[model samples]
Target chain A: MIPIKKQYRRLRSLLFALSSVIMFFIFWELIALYSPSPYVPDPYSVLKAFITMLTVGDIDGYTLTWHALVSLERVLLGFIVGAATGVPIGMLLGIKPTLKGAVTPIIEPLRFIPPIAWIPLSIVLLIGLWRYIFLIWIGVFFPVLLDTIAGVKRTSITLIQMAKTFGADNKKIIARVIFPSSLPEIMNGLRVGLGVGWMCIVAAEMIGGEPVGLGRLILKYANLLQIDVVIVGMITIGLIGLTLNYFILLLEKRLFKWRVEIRA
Target chain B: MKKAILLESVSKKYEVGSSSLEVIKSLTFDVNENEFVCIVGPSGCGKTTLLRLVSGLEPPTSGRILIFGDPPDPRKQRFGVIFQEDSLLPWRTVIGNVKFGLELQGYKESEHEKIARTYIELVGLQGFENYYPHQISGGMKKRVAIARALAINPDLILMDEPFADLDAQTRSLMQRELLNIWSKLNKTVLFITHNVEEAVFLAQRVFVLTKRPSRVKQIINIDLPYPRARLSPPFISYRERILTAFHEELEGI
Candidate 1:
């Protein structure tokens, strides 16, 4: 049970956040009223559009929910593949300096190129979903890879020494000590990678000739001067990104409870 | 009595920049089976280095270190080492940390919890078995380290000022607890500490060392029985002797 003082503090913070959001919508409504621009839809119009997109089918041959689901699927698949491959490669490079030296020169250059920048080449190389996946994978890969490597490198020497003195072989040491020790950093990597992947998926969908994705819907509606639908798409993307980040944070809290308690 | 460890002319030198610094200079000592021995020296006297060399964590520049009539190899003969640092795995609970050595040894999964719990209880941490290292006090964390070490059931234990981080009262309490456990287990122990009183209180024999490039200065035997009184005449006299030997080295420097 929370104390009254703590409960009051939490309630105050919540009210503060809610008021700021309400003020933002009011400011946006006032701008819409004064400007009378078709491009800048009012908050109420966007909300109505959001509900219409939710209930009605055939916005762009599919409902808004379908478009959001398709985008989420692509991002999820791309992020999973990126993490699965990147973590192992990163662990290998972290443990084996010679291999890192050999591969770093190749990867270092590729890391600088933004994922959205790869859309043209990805389209030429692949078709439809694969192109979007490729772009999303590129977006997710580098952060996870670099962070995993850094985490592995930062494992405490004392922990490693302790493992070794207990007669642990190289494999056991990595599995038991280094991997668990590097988890917080790896989780950070995944969080950052997922955020990048979300953005890349939206950008990729806008140009990848995809018919049913939130990004494609926004692009289509904007071309037709349906500003409310476009705003709905934009808001959906933000909400989904926020939800994904919250899920990752929840996982981190569960897994690294010891770490959290230590900081507290 | 059987000899548990024998170090002959062990020397360790570290190469800093271009010049090499000798840390342990031709140090020679032997610890018997089931004996509790402490090495007391001034702070930063290469005492930890000596333990590291003995444990084969680091190699000596020159000398022979034998454990039970063989060269010291962690794989060949297990030696539980408790470092000055808590060294508890933050992610693991008390029982989990205690079971770590057993897991590395590839013991049966079924046996781990039981064995770990036994040691945890032995270290007076029965109720805190599921508590993570971060959740425990410094003294409790040290107890976890001890439990982890003892759970391995190693041939010998090498401790490097394991209680040095605790407060004076907690340090004395832990020393007593350690003595209780050691007597019951009859484990061979080589403890390193800068505290002269701690050395005399816990050890059957105390080896005093010089300040830097440390060599064995003297070995004093504490003839007092177990459950030694802190204020007793013999205990005080032994403590004084070790203190004087330690101060002489400091003064010479």
Candidate 2:
């Protein structure tokens, strides 16, 4: 059980967060009232637009949930594809020092080019779904690869030697020792990769001007001066990103029960 | 008295960047079946390197090593190794870590579980079989490593300073428990340590090694009986002898 003092501290922190959010909304409302421009819609107007978009649908006859689903599909598809390719290649390179060394020079330059920078090339060369996937792939691939390599390299020499003394061959050693031990790091890589993929979603949808995505809806509404709807789109993206990261954290907790709990 | 391990002029040289560093030079010894031998030396005297060579984890630069009659081939001749550091897989439960060797040997889950449980019980960790390495104390972790090594039913067991990290009280308790287990199992053990008292307490014969480019300086037979009293005059003399050898090596350095 948590001590009373610690619990009280936690409660105090929660209250502080709630008060800060209230303060932000109040400040925004004051700004909207004084501003001459129509672009800065207050928090209440954004909330009102959000409910209407969810229930009554937007002007294009599609609901906010539909836009969210489209964005989610792109993110999930691209994330899965990127992980499938990245993990195996990462494991191969991680196990073979010579292969990693040879590949490093070529990959080092490419890794520096972020997902957004690939936009111009993707828009020109890729067609339809591939363009979105390509952009998100570029975002997700490197972190997962690098983390997996680090995890494998960080495998304890003591454990490997112990395994060898038990008469374990290379394949058995890798399967029984290397893979399971490296999982915590791999999960961490996946979480970071998913975050990058979600960040790239806005630019990815912007590439082809996709008709149904949150990114597209935000831009489309902004063009018509519907600042309230644009704010709703932005809020949805933030909430979804938070939800995705929370989901990964929960999964990590369940899978790695042996890991020391780091409750910061 | 069958020879379980034989080392003939065993030497290990590690090439560091440009220059070659010799860690072990001409270590010749034989460990008989069911005998417990300890290699005690000053720190960085290549006690670990010698163990690595005997376990076939590394090849000797110019000497021959044999397990039983054949060359030290880890894949062909099974050996149990316990490292100085905690090598227990944090992700595995006590039983799972013990079952690791059986799993690699292609034993079915059902069969391996029974074998693993026996060793876990042998190490007095039966009730804590489900506990992870992190959940246990340091002493328990060492026991789990022991159970893991012994579960494989290896011909020889090589331990490198297995209790070096334990508290003094726990270390003494563990030593007694280890002796109990060793007598019961009748397994050959080649243990290494830097502590003179630990060598005197555990080993039937203590092989002292000199400083860098280490070689056997003296092999002292512990003629003392089991449950050997640390405060006993014989035990004190044994400790003094090894300590004096260590001091001589330091002085030479």
Candidate 3:
């Protein structure tokens, strides 16, 4: 049914997208080579350092893999902790109107404040620097919670009516209707919150004294005036973020196969 | 004749900022077993709301609705409803949507599956049982909704413009298909729609309603044969009377 013109346009768009990304990286690599600056390392130098990190271990102080592993641990711990507490709480707020009314007043303002803003308090209250994970958890919790409630609210009124018309009681309606209806939005919130969590990794590492993480690695290179390694760290973080985002997108597109999008 | 559904002076009101909006006010009707009653009303006439009240989905403001002269209970499993939209659960496979009522009625999983399969096959959705609502076409979804309603085998079925949204061709096909099913099963249907031709085609009797806080204006009986031709003299007369009643609402005001 699709016209060949549309098919050709789609091909053009795909090629355009691929070339744009390829060119961006190629340009960055070229500039690093030709530019004469001690601070800025060329693409080849960065690759050498990357290879060195794999084989030679620590370039500045911490090994590249070492920082990656540590950052991975922190993210996992914080994400798990946030989800463990946040999911149930979101469900409660979503399902029980009384719970929402009582809790919304408290959660509303607290949600507006950034998680990184809590760094100063975390240091004061908990063990110094380790509280960064707690801060990341805080950042992720609100979006997931609010979006969950929003998702529950978005459940169609007709669906509730349909269930009830079929002799479904309150419990049956909630269990069968509200729960599934909220799944898509819950996933959306989780993905958005996670992106925030990853971006906040740098903030977490910077606040907490760490020889690990691309964030802290960059800070180390900045002091040494090795801008190429700094760019490498930035690229590394960007790649990791892209990887995580892609996985979330993949899960969304895969698991919710029932999604029939309104194609433009 | 067996009185299948009875609405005894049933009334429903909505309070909006010190103003009371009465959608159904002391409205009463009785549908005999195997009878087809069509409620024709303009938008916001609470045609759908009345059906919901009869189905036990919504309680009346001051009166009670009864299935077979007793207070209506969804647990009795006597009423089936098809909304304007199919309202099929997007997450559920077509068969799952059809089996919903049976499952609610406490039918065992195996028996439920058997019934669902039979009805989906009857409604021309055998191959689509495994397909989700989003995967199917709108007409197919409507058929599934009809199948879902019929799967319960209720004494009385309430339908609110079930095919109003479909293209004319599909709507005509559905009307014929529904009549075939209704004729065979002898199911009592209280159908609501604004389409005069549809009201004539589907119902044994059409109760036309006035616009804005409507009450029944006329109950025109169609005594023609099954699969009544729209071009018949009596059928056109009935349509004219209903249309005149509707026009009176606009012209008089």
Candidate 4:
């Protein structure tokens, strides 16, 4: 409650974080040195491999940054395409009875089939790079679509009636009230969809090796028995995923501050 | 007095399995300008159904409703409604919730800002303009809902058990504040409640309904003086008459 206590708490948190990093690195490096096999490299050696991947361009051609960039571009493009259509489709289905009934049956079944199942069909239909993009798009679209619809449906009937009584037309009610009210759920869908998209991309990249990506790099190292390099690639993937999720959360906080429940 | 709201032979029905259940039966009433009309009845007596019909939220199965000499056009007639729930927009500040109807009615930004500020102060939320609905107490939220309706300056205000969720202390305060607001604004109010004392306290005329196929059991005019004393002989007599009628109506149901 007091200013002094708040400052002390912040300093304590900073110290705790610093000690955790030091202790974790020390234990990891110490364990790797006396290990029985080459699979578990020392933390220092893994760091060296990470540096080589970044500075000298790992494997044959591309650098670590190159793989991360390529992966980022694919996911971002697929997410944009998926959300651009998914949100409106979801909203339309939720609001209109006839549309919901007709379309929901189709969506209900299609959503259950894993995006991986369409790999062969996608390869048969589309050319090289587009296949991977299509798989990622499919992975993201359904979760986002379903969640958006659920959110719109959950809007309170009283709020709708209130808007209607106050002279809000169908268009104004949808655009102004329902859409903003549904944002928290739509954002939730997008978050889940992105995770599915990430998983789909990794599976596709490893199997197909169609482009420069972390998934492809990890696969390349795994095949060559460079387990440490593979581990490095996987860790980078995790870190990048964390960074992307953090950005989404930041955007959510800024735009939908109302969704954050007031402490009072 | 100028007539603002009128219903003629209005009734509503809903299909129930193999039979049709009629809710409102040949109900007709007129709300004069600046008059406060309270509709009180036993539970499931279609008090809510009548309010919805008047506000054009639900259409009567048979009869027509005319507001201001024309069929009620929701777009042209911006009515304010306070439900049992506060119905405050969760994302908005106290002022934002108050300004919602004004914004939808195309009131200019500056004009609404002034009006919202004035009304927020009126509802005793002067320092809570930036507080979101979730941050406010239940009583505070109710006040904001009241302020929002007032800011819109609707020709009619329909309230359905608006104080039902509030504590007795808060409900009494809200009643006094509501009467003060009614005296100042003079909007035709159609308030629905089941509390006998509440109906007797607030209304010019209390329209009681029968159980199912709810028709007007009786429309009792409160001849008790304004600023009514609760212990007065006339007030108690009117309440006793309504309760006795309610008892007979319940027995029939």
Candidate 5:
């Protein structure tokens, strides 16, 4: 059983979070009441729009769920492709300093350019699903690559020495020692990569190739000046992002149970 | 007895910025098969550098190191080395850590598990085979390190103050345990330490080393039998002799 004081603290934090969310809605409603512009809808109207879009189909005969699913599929595919390519390239660069040095100039410039900046280029060079995948891939790739490199670089020297003493050569040391040691860092990269990939969905869907994504739904409703419908789409995106982030965090905890956090 | 390890005029120097800093100054020694030798020195006296040279982790600036009539090369030779710091892989469990060396040496997975289990039991960590490095105590982690080293069945084992980080009680307990393992296995050991008492208690012969630019100042034979008493007159005298050599080196005498 948890201590009484700890339980009390948990309850208090829960209440604070609930109150904060309630206060945000009240403040938003007040803004809608006093606003001269019709773009800011009240929280209640947005909630109604969400329920209607969930139960009955929207103007495109597709529910909000279908749009969110489309967005999720794009994010998942992009994130997987990013990780598959990033990990091997990152490991190669990490192991060979000369290779990293030669490639750094080119990758450095590309990494700084955001996914949104690549929109026009991707649209012109790619078609349909590939366009969205390319944009999201751009957002996901760099973080995974950088994190994997950091992980490989940060492996304990003592552990490497220990492996060497046991008649392990360079290849064996990398596979057995460096790889396992770098896993926690690699997992962090995947988590960050997924978050960035999800964020790219909006810009990806807005390219006009895909018409059923949450981002497209939001854009369509906004064009018709149905502010409540747009707000509903916005809330759905926020919820999905939160869920995705939390899912990866849970996976990290499960995979690395040996990790001891030195919390004060 | 055959010479398990032979070092002739081994010296190591570091190039720090522009000026060179000498750490080891022409060290020469030999450790025989089944012998337990301890090198005692002041801190930062290149004792670790000596061990590194022996394990072939680093090369000496000059002189030659031979293990069983061959030059020591970690990639080719089977040498067991436990470092001064914690080196057990945190991602691996006790058994997994022990099996790591075996796996790298190309032993089949089915064959290595039993071998790993034997070493785990030998180190008195049988119950904690499934426990990770973080789950075990300092002494236990040290045991896992020992087991990992021993699992490779190396003829020469080098330890760099393996119990230096333990508490006083745990350090002594580990010292006794180490003696037990060393005697039972009958393997050659070249252990490095700063504690004169620890050196006297564990070694068949204690080699006293001086401060930085360190060289072997004295080699005192410890003729006391197994389970040597720390409080005994002979043990105290051996400890004092090594301590005097260290103190004289510190005083520049």
Candidate 6:
């Protein structure tokens, strides 16, 4: 059971957090009231638009939930494919420095070319869903690969030496020691890659005539000068990003329960 | 007694930039079966390098190291090594880390848990089986390292200053615990440390080495019985003899 003082302290912090959020909305509402600009919709109008889009059968071509689900599918598929391929190649590069030295020069220049910049080439070479998947994959691949390589390189020499002394062959050492030790860094890379992949899917949807994604809906409404609908789209993206990040953090905490903060 | 390990004039030289820095020079020693031997030397006198050479983690620049009358090879011979650092895997629990060596050796899946549990209890970590290394104290982590080494049932154990990081009280307590474990297992152990008192307290014989281009300076046999008294005259005399020999090496440098 929590102590009474500790419970009171937690309640106080919660109240403060709630007040801060309330204060932000109040400030936005006041600004909207004084200015009365079409560009800056009041919070009530944005909330109303959000609900209406959720219930209505058509926002652009499909309901808001359908648009979100389509974008989620694209992001998940691209992220999985990118991670599945990137992690193994990264591990290979990490173990074989000579091979890494040969391949790095080519990858270094290509990775710098942003996923959005690949849109023209993707459009020319691919059609429909492949285009979206290609962009998202490009966005997700490099971070995971680079981070995995860095993680492998950072594995403790002492741990490897200890494993060897215990009669572990090279294969066993790599499978048991190197892989598990690099997990924290790999998870961090996945989190970063997920964010980048989500952004790429939204940007790709905006450019392509997807007709069923959140980005497409945002573009359609913005073109018609419906500021409230645009605001609704932005809020949806933010909420989804926040939710996905929260899940990643929860997974990290669960997997890395062994990590503890050292106090001075 | 059968020879558990023999080092014939083993030398280690590391190339730094263009110059070669000799670490161990013409060092030779032998440990008999089930003997607890400690190597004491001035800091940076290649004690760890010697342990690594015997463990076959690194080859000696010159001379030979043998285990049971054959040249040592890590893949073919079973040797457990405890490093100076708390080398427990941060991702695994106490039981998982203890079972690491057995798992690597491809022990039967059914036997792994029983063996790991036995060693965990042997190390007095019965209730901490599920706790991660980070959650345990430094002394406890060292115990886990010992348990991990013992779980494999290796032919010999090489330890490199395994308790140098603990406080004096904890270090003394671990020393006693280690002695108890060593006596019960009857395994050959090659322990390395710079602490003269610790070396005198733990080993049946202490091999003292000179600084820098290190070689055995003196070999002092400790004939004291088990549960040696630190305050007793014989214990103090043994400590003094090792300290004097060690200081002489320091002065020569």
Q: What digit string (tens of lDDT, one per residue) describes model 1 on residues A1-264? A: 999999999999999999999999999999998885657889998889888888894455588889899999999989999899889888999999899999989999999998778878887899867887788899899999999999999998888888888888899989999999988889999999999999886678866465788888888888889999888988999999999999999899888988955255
Off by over 4 Å in 5: A1-9, A97-109, A262-264
DockQ winner = 2
- For candidate 1, give the DockQ: 0.69
Candidate 5 residue A175 C-alpha distance from true site, Å: 2.1
Give the TM-score of each candidate.
Answer: 0.94, 0.95, 0.87, 0.91, 0.94, 0.93
Interface Cα RMSD for candidate 3? 1.3
Model 6, stretches more than 4 Å misplaced?
A: A1-4, A30-39, A96-111, A262-264
Instruction: Give the per-residue lDDT digits (tens) of candidate 6, residues A168-261.
Output: 8888888998988888888888888888888776677856676878777788888888888888888888888788888998898888887774
Deviation from native of the Cα of residue A213 in model 6, angstroms: 0.8
Best by TM-score: 2
Give the per-residue lDDT of model 3 (tens digit) for A1-264: 989999999999999999998898799877766778645676778888777766666655567878877776777677777777777788778878898999878988997887668877887887754686787788778778888888888888888888888888888987788878888888888888787777777777767465778778877777788776777777778888788888988898876777676211
Model 1 alpha-carbon miss at residue B216, Å: 1.2
The lDDT values for all models are 0.89, 0.89, 0.82, 0.84, 0.90, 0.89
How do the residues B1-253 of candidate 6 rate in per-residue lDDT, one tens digit apiece?
Answer: 4489998899999999999999999998999999999999988898888888899888999998889987888778888888999789988999999989888877898998999999999999999999988889999999999999999898999899999999999999999999999999999999999998898889999999999898988999999998888889999999999999999988887
lDDT of 5 by residue, A1-264 (tens): 999999999999999999999999989999999999978889988989999999896897889999999899999999999999988888889888899999999999999998888989997899888888899999899999999999999998899888888878888888888888888888899899999999888888889855698988988998999999998888899899999999988888888887896211
Q: Could you tell which candidate, 4 or 5, scores higher by TM-score?
A: 5
Model 5 chain A is weakest, by summed lDDT over 10 consecutive residues, at: A255-264
Tens-digit lDDT string for candidate 1 (B1-253): 4479998998999999999999889899999999999999988889988887878788889999889988877777787999888698999988989999999887899999999999988999989988888788999999999989999899999999999899999999999999999989999999999898898889999999998898899999899998999899989988988889899998987
* Model 2 / residue B235 / CA error / Å: 2.3
- Which regions of candidate 3 fall more than 4 Å away from where they truly are? A1-38, A59-62, A84-108, A127-130, A207-211, A220-225, A262-264, B75-78, B250-253
Error of 1 at B186 (Å): 0.8
Residue B251 lDDT (model 3) = 65
Chain A TM-score relative to the true structure, per candidate: 0.93, 0.92, 0.81, 0.85, 0.95, 0.90
Identify the CAPRI category of the predicted complex in candidate 5: medium
